[model samples]
Target: MPNHLVPIAFELPHITLRGLTNNLTHKPLIVALHGWLDNAASFIPLLTEVTDYHIIALDWAGHGLSDHRPPGTDYQQFDYIDDLHQLLTEQKWENVILMGHSMGGILSSIYAATFPEMVRAVVSIDAMGPITTESSVAENLRTGVLSRHQRRAKRSIASPVPLTQLIDKRQQHTELSGELVELLIKRATRPVIVEAGDGGTQVVWRTDSRLRNASLIRLTEQQAQELMTELSCPMQIIIADDGLLAKRGLWQQREQWFGSAEIVHLTGGHHLHMYNTEQIWAPIAAFLHNIST
Candidate 1:
């Protein structure tokens, strides 16, 4: 419930966006990006475990309270980096720590490599693999369009429930404390729902289609290798044992990007961090501490 936000102009004078930030004793900044379909609340448990580093958690365009996608334009995954770039420009924080989950994780990795001098360290929660698992760009686009279409339909008509009620709904999907759940609920839903169901109403969308579509441009293995080599700061990679990788060694060989890097393995599926924060957050804390000191 300690999350806070203040509206700010990001790219254009007329185009302002909400910048979400988390504070714990006013520590160093760690810009955190949530995974696909998730908001900044995704980092709550991890944030609670850390006593150092102020966490900057963001909602991707069309995801959380951030500005929805520009009229007819679909979500562009690359633009996420651009958004953060504008944020850093406005906030005037360079060579800061960056951490993210899933899509956000991939984004922080890309930015750290792209802006080596501006990033002091980068952490990928579970999104630092080769961009595409497919062979054709057309196929990628096709896949993206279908997924995005579904997401748009869902979010566009999602109904709002009372904050407490919304948290109950989210609990159906995950087992989080009631208080933590409330924090997430308040950040996502509005005060009213025009179409509340008889006993309870459903939020129109649980996921964003634009983000799925934006990932059509995947990096080839060669391209990924090149990006890995481009990283100039400290880096940390955390992979789950139950993740989608066919082989873990692929990531092991890519650590050449940083002057110093560490790898840790967690047990569970892609979302082990959310489901098992107490166990996995330890190494992440150590990694960040070492980098900042």
Candidate 2:
């Protein structure tokens, strides 16, 4: 039988998060988080490949079907940690197994470090930890603040386009298969009326465009190292052979921060978890199994 994914929404004090889950009755929750501009749908392929545990894949705030932050407020990297903490507390989930991809992987590492007691294990794909800023401290802060100020007054409604065009555009950039592109388009867009030119209706992305902007603050290399040192839970860092980390010579440094964590190199792109599910699942499953035993 095909796995059934139940749509769920968590109403929090600050924002509402939309997610999809399978087997809520199972213990030791596995939370899957997606990359920037992507949504919970990104995990569908992976979820379908693994059915041993209950898993919930969340659309981060301002992405997918989740609620966006109030106007004039930009998305800060640390805010995601707070949001996840609140969600876990509200749901009374302890000893969580975080499975995060790309940007989500970075957030997962931070969360595991920030609240080591609550996490049982972390499975990070295509990213080791938070990205560090190389710019001078003063310049980094200045640019972040300036960008927010400049973008605050420039908010505008996005123009709608045909669904096929949206999928085609994403395919061009990500090189994702048509099947995966269609799945993302379905979760990330909403139908709307377009009164200009053709005067027909179409779909537009549901994610807050502000998310495309850089964060207001970023962790420095020293801070990231500190965070990595604080991680007590077993971690699994999976690097794709052709992904960004491998290309930039950063994957070689994974052992420095995650000394005890298991590192595996596979053949695929950054989104291997979505595109090459089987290749990625074995290591993650083995890690989870070992921790549980």
Candidate 3:
């Protein structure tokens, strides 16, 4: 199918949200949020299946073409919730259908709970709510402060490299197919002029280096439970059979947190949505259809 997606930028006071949208005139706006270190292009596969509703896939604050956070500021998980709130308010959106992957999925669930009346439904892929920390409060706070300072003080600009090398490097870490890797490279990189041999230019990942820093803090088990219990919309969570949730024994506990949620298991790794798009799309489409009618 021909690509019908349009690149869009949502300007905010602090940072701009970069994303792609399709069929903007449609109702019940569907917003897709990508996983950590990923960009809006992660949702391109769904465009072929989810044609009935308007869709917007965002690149969060520091990913893709979006602006990075101000210097000296750490990337906090809650900051995403604030950004989403601003985006929805600016667009005058209500009862939105949110679909998120990995970190995005966690954020979407938190947002739905925080403002239950604003979300119609939620589709979480390979994650559910926030991951709670078992560390003591004092220890957690101390570690967070030290880590943030160390990361900020040592931050440096990323050197540009050939696109082919970038793809090869990423492939070593994940089982993503060549096609998907190429797609991500296209969305997450830009050409840069080099002062080398022939003064040639190369493409580099456009993500902010600060995004690699560890989260400043994490929700406690009690906090995560509270957020999950507060969710008022229909929810669907898809976990890959070999995914992180399964490995860490979190699926059962996470599933119990939601009052109204259905859980399904698919066959793939953490990024099942990118590699097994068709399988992932079926459940998502069904959830959206059921909620809309």
- Each prediction's TM-score versus the true structure: 0.76, 0.94, 0.92
Best by TM-score: 2
lDDT of each: 0.67, 0.86, 0.84
Q: What's model 2's overall lDDT?
A: 0.86
Off by over 4 Å in 1: 2-15, 24-26, 141-186, 194-198, 206-209, 212-216, 245-260
Error of 2 at 274 (Å): 1.0
Name the TM-score of candidate 3: 0.92
Score residue 189 of candidate 1 by CA lDDT. 57
User: Candidate 2 residues 15-73, lDDT tens each?
Assistant: 99998888656655899999988999999888888768889999999988899998767
Please provide, for model 3 over 1-293, each residue's C-alpha lDDT reduced to its tens digit, 9 standing for 90 to 100. 23688888999978899898886665568889999989988888776566678888999998988888987786789999999999998988988989999999999999998988889888999898897898988888888887778877886777778777777788888878877887787778888865565544578778877787766678899988987888888999999998989988888876668757888889999888876878888888887888768
Among the numbered candidates, top lDDT falls to 2
RMSD of each: 4.4, 2.5, 2.5
